[model samples]
Target: MVTDKEGYAQLIQYLTEHLGLFENAGSGVDGSTVMELFEDLLAAQIIVVCGQNPELSFSQRNTIIREVDAIMYDLEEILAGCGRQQVNREQSYFITEFTGLVKNLFDHEIAQLVR
Candidate 1:
């Protein structure tokens, strides 16, 4: 049985290897940016899972949310330096591709804990 951490690692590896698929031409989004966005989005989704899991204490959920907020702040800083139009395009592409990847590769299990 794969632990949650291992499952998350596998998903991250898969996403990293397929980072190009999320890239938008002329969007000014580099591979590193795409990966960061991917990670941030994944972390955001995990907060939802954390909320639903009775196993996690309120403090644990708050901690995870706080960490995710920090990540979002960093991501916001990166986007702030980018062109608004380009960032919007890249963000749209990332959301579409990321959602598709989760549906296809992980059968819509964003956390991949079920696998």
Candidate 2:
């Protein structure tokens, strides 16, 4: 289902695992707060994406994926800036290059974060 809640839930779960934002409490002083904000913002984006027709066209899907890629990159940079995490900018962008929301969902679930 392309509903907002489903996509929001998936992104939360994915971020929980990959970013360890929800699990790792002893990370930093303001890190948890930032992570929470990130979740809220990401969920908000997903809500808009899900509001669109579930059966999105190729360009629609790709546009959403691109938006998601950009959002994730920004969040990752924020985390890295605060020394809470380390991510390779080039590597992350590469993931977006081949990222499609349907098949590579495990790796691209965060790409559902679209406005």
Candidate 3:
């Protein structure tokens, strides 16, 4: 299991690295790259969750994974739409909203784990 501080640091680093994806919206954003990013985010979430709750049952872990996967699917659709269009005001807003959602996840759900 990772130490709380270490896990927190890793989450922060992950956010830092991926923030650029939003910053450079519509810049050759491909489906594969988007999928890769979502996969990485899911991995980070799972690691942090499992590290914090080592005693979680297998079923519980599976449930958590399924929930996160559903959320990711919705976000992925929004991102894919953004990628398919020119970077206009509406798309920019969606990108901003998506960034906020990710940040909020770290700030609330993930931070609660590490804390």
TM-score of 2: 0.33
Better of 1 and 3 by lDDT: 3
**Candidate 1, superposed: residue stretches over 4 Å from native:** 1-47, 83-90, 96-115
lDDT of 2 by residue, 1-115 (tens): 2323465456445543555432333434333344344444455545555554466666766766666666566556545543333223432332233223323342234344432
Across residues 31-96, which tens digit of lDDT does each residue of candidate 3 receive? 334445555555665676567677666875675666566656655554563333335343344444
Location of the lowest summed lDDT over 10 successive residues in candidate 1: 102-111
Query: Candidate 1 clash total?
Result: 0
* TM-score, cand. 3 vs. native: 0.45
Candidate 2, RMSD to the unseen true structure: 11.0
Best of the candidates, lDDT = 3
At residue 115, give the lDDT of candidate 2. Answer: 25
Q: Write down the lDDT of every candidate, Cα atoms only.
A: 0.47, 0.44, 0.50
Cα error, residue 55 of model 2, in Å, equals: 6.5
- Checking candidate 2 for backbone clashes, the offending pairs are none
Q: What's the candidate order when arranged by decreasing lDDT?
A: 3, 1, 2
In angstroms, the error of model 2 at 34 is 1.6
